[model samples]
Target: MPDTPPEFSESADSDAVAEDNEFDSLRGILADGVVGAAGGLVGTAMMTVVFLIAQSVGAFELTDFAILMELLGLSEVVPPVLFGFLLFLGGGMVPWPLLFASLKAYLPGESSPVSGAFFGAAMWSGFVLAFYTGQTGLSLVLYGILTLVAHVVYGIGLGAVFDYFETRPDSIV
Candidate 1:
């Protein structure tokens, strides 16, 4: 075995580094985008829920809620909790699963946390902003922080568990 050229080894190392960097950068972007969308969905759900409850209890003007709902082609009043959960699940888990699955195809060797932290954080961000829109409250900060953490944990945990299951010997992403 003749001595390998230094240039050959250096080039190979650079290629590996570049590849890793690209992979990380892509994952980061995907993670961020998924989180953002999830947050938005949660916020929207929260707002809609509030509107429904307000209408039912007369806390929010019926005319306004009705008009909004009618415009959206929704004719039914929905439970706030249902909306909240939908928003939470949609924001916290929807994107991650898709993102994780897509990433698996490209980066099967990459590490993705099972906890739903990513979506949680992102959804929480949107939730905070939406909740605080044109309003001030003492619990705003607390709710915001809690929302973020809850969503993130859910997202990360879900991811971890998902990955765990997917890691079975015969599993395929």
Candidate 2:
């Protein structure tokens, strides 16, 4: 009151609040990215288990990397298996996770896991359409079933990770 007008003081206070809100928004974005990446790691690992089992049981021969290799035309230039796997892993950790985090709020489900499953299933449609493996008969059916199951497992794992982080006392988001 002595040094500054009331209006000026009010303006300063509002400015400070606005700055804090901006910071909080940025922080929330970072938190979502980090959490989503972590969830992706877990989700990818779970998906890999299903794939390995399915491969062993002769359900299908294609891995995530295999499809990626063909799609990217890297099979001839690089060691397809190793390079493709690395690419797949990197993709799982970043883009997919970020996308999942962005869409989580809008997805339908009673819980995080359920929502994640829906997300995975939705993603599956893309995979089936974009990366058709050309299987037929029993193998095709098994491939469809097994891949769907794998995706659901992946989503469950991802959502579980999100749930775990969200419930923590010092949760970022």
Candidate 3:
């Protein structure tokens, strides 16, 4: 057999597991491109998915949770769900502006404040949702404070994600 160079010669995908685990691959690309973007989508969707499922199973009604029991089902959930949907839309849009702004600072491109603001808002929304979920001691002060810090971090994730791709051109989502 021409002295067979090696039986276990490593191949490009030799270590790849034999499963249709595309989600991880996609997530890795997305995270590398935008950490929060990928993480946010997965996290938020997971929560909302569970919530929606619970609604069908009457999970909201089963607990002593006031928000679900006391508040208007149609009204309360709708606003927040809509609010979250808007945030996700904004989430998708947040990073590019910061990326371009970075371009303005170092590279050559138009920097957009609107994009930055959207990015900030999306990040803030994550924190706000967290506080909103707590029924015992939900307060505006907590929401406001957390929102401010999270927004800044969200913007950074955008820039970092974009930059990561710059260095790793071989990467793809």
Compare the candidates by lDDT and give the number of the best one.
2
Model 1, clash count?
19
Looking at candidate 3, the ten consecutive residues that score lowest on lDDT are 60-69
Each model's TM-score? 0.43, 0.79, 0.32
Which residue runs does candidate 1 get wrong by more than 4 Å?
A: 1-96, 103-110, 114-116, 131-137
lDDT of 2 by residue, 106-153 (tens): 999978899989988887887665545677888778778888988888
Arranged by TM-score, best first? 2, 1, 3
The local lDDT score (0 to 100) that residue 137 gets in candidate 2 is 84
Candidate 3 residues lying further than 4 Å off, grouped into runs, are 1-83, 94-138, 169-173
Better of 1 and 3 by lDDT: 1
lDDT of each: 0.47, 0.79, 0.44
Which ten residues in a row are the worst by lDDT in model 2?
A: 58-67
Clashing residue pairs in candidate 3 (N, C-alpha, C atoms within 3 angstroms): none
lDDT for position 150 in model 3: 45
